[model samples]
Target: MTDQDDLLPIGLEDALPARAAAITRAMRAVLDTMDAHGYDRVRPPLIEFERSLAGRMQGVATRRMVRFTDPESLRTLALRGDMTVQVGRIAATGLAEAPRPLRLCYAGEVALLRADQLDPARQRLQMGAELIGSDAVSAASEAVLLAIASLEAAGLSDISVDFTLPDLVDVLADEALPLAADQRDAVRRELDTKDAGGLAAAGGQAYLPLLYATGPFAEAAAKLKALDAGGELASRIEGLEAIADRIGGRARITLDPTERHGFEYQSWFGFTIYAAGARNAIGRGGTYTIRGSEEAATGFSLYAEPLLEASGNAREAARDTLFLPLGHDTAIADRLRAIGWRTIAAIGESDDPRALGCSHRLEGSEALPV
Candidate 1:
């Protein structure tokens, strides 16, 4: 092969053996947990017609998609940049008549034209669950709780969740301090950066208190209530409080009422999950409306790469592969597997099992340390 053919494009990567095994194990654990919770698994295509994938969500930018023309159909096709959108499409068309509060889960790879600052890889492994046909608080609460459980099942510890009211700014601005679109954008940018002065200068003084209302759930809720904002703003805060109450003593929970980025489509509540050692968020999701319909859905997608990084225990456990001698008994191999050992039979003569990345080796009737 030529040198050019051997090089991979920027933002793309090949997951080597160790990392690949860890990712597979993590994803399987998460999917199994979701299945236990009654979330039916579904596999969506990696590519679809451009319009169908984009749907009506304003957050799904066309430039971020890797698009090309299909030769056979003479139509534009694009690699899916977000699996949530595909799941939404599935609920709307294929599973439209399934049932109320349909629970679905999916895990797949998505390619993006650009990556965010926190996650630099454009190609990502996204594993998540979605609940459709219900906008009730119970649905949102269940999604959040299930996400925490899945991350724990993947062997992550000290997991914490930060809740965001994506529509809080708009609700406050519309009711208390009406501003033009540009002014609202400026205020949002200021709030995102925690620039109190910029927010006040941009005619968002009424919403300035939100800058300080970010911390532990109870403390932040108290500060928010003190802002004296009533109507929908109050209702949104109450909803967040309700979610917190439901998730009590399950996982560490915090509140960030002013966060607006990365949740362009979420309607009421948005959230992000963090682990003890990871440098970036492990997952994020919230309540959103499937485009062209009023059905409310809530779910999250966990980034496998980062989760695997934070889960040191998972990596160590994945490395415990056992090497079996050539022509070893098949029944013994089956029994070893039943006891939670990953055994690989030797194909040819070899002196060292370590050369083949096996931690243990089988000798006669008993397995010996390598």
Candidate 2:
């Protein structure tokens, strides 16, 4: 039986040895891939002033952040639920004068105050790269391609991207479909849930075509084009075409133009990426204007846990290990380690090399299979 004192809270747990190794390997691969692409890595503090944290991003829900009064500043400090906001702040303040289209990547643990029904964990590992100062089609394309590269480096295959227009409602409501002010929010809510009945109830029956304009990219994009009776969506449609062309055959592409579920602040374009074996999206990215600086940026955030799950390995194959018995030559062991051998020294003469996960026994200076 487990003791009450040893019980963990509902949404948190330790990653045992093997799992930790997998997460570490995945993190390294992702960060290295981003670095190779000239995305400088940044490490932001886990907690920041609640106001500063909340002020930098539009969709960041302060209610979902774990907050507490800081004894030193007497101001509220909040654990970050996302690192993209902090990256935005960095680009706006510290690197404000950096050249246009600054690139930054980060990996960190984020905690939420409460878990949602669909996603149970309140804490998760988020990794992302932000391209600051540009939300143009080229920037969007780069973000999408880089996201695929990073996930691929982390050992995921058969990745798919579902694209969205975060501001689809606002754009149509403004002119093309002209919705009443009171009906706008209801329409967005209904569409987010894919509820056709609720959409009509909310006075958005005119926008019903958007519901079916979701599927394979080629088909959905064509449907979306036909639905645009006016030329209001012409530019947006063209931009999507440009991005999809850039993607080529690298990933499976689909379009859900009105998907506003996890996207709170993306502007023209957004995407949720999924691996073949994952149940939910492993990453999401899009274009947005940074809140404080009002500068355009494109970025994506990927979760490590989902990446590991989709990769289907809690740990990788065991590496070749050498066991050193008592009184073994220390210098020889050092040489073996330097040459890529993993050495585990015996504590006693009776210690079994196989039990210690050592594939070879260090007999004298040579490693021989046990």
RMSD of each: 2.6, 1.4
Query: Which pairs clash (backbone N, Cα, C closer than 3 Å) in model 2?
Result: none
Candidate 2 structure quality by residue, lDDT tens digits, 1-370: 6698698899988998899999999999999999999999999999999998899878788998999999999999999999999999899888999898899999999999998788889999999999998999999999999999998999888999999999999999988998999999999999999999999999999999999999999999999999999978889989998999999999999999989988888998999999988888999999999997899999999998789989996568879999999999999999889989999999988999999899999888788999
| Candidate 2 to truth, TM | 0.97
Q: TM per model?
A: 0.90, 0.97
Clashes of each: 0, 0
Q: 53, model 2: CA deviation in Å?
A: 1.5
Give the Cα lDDT of each candidate: 0.85, 0.93
Off by over 4 Å in 2: none
* Strongest candidate by TM-score: 2
Clash pairs, candidate 1, are none
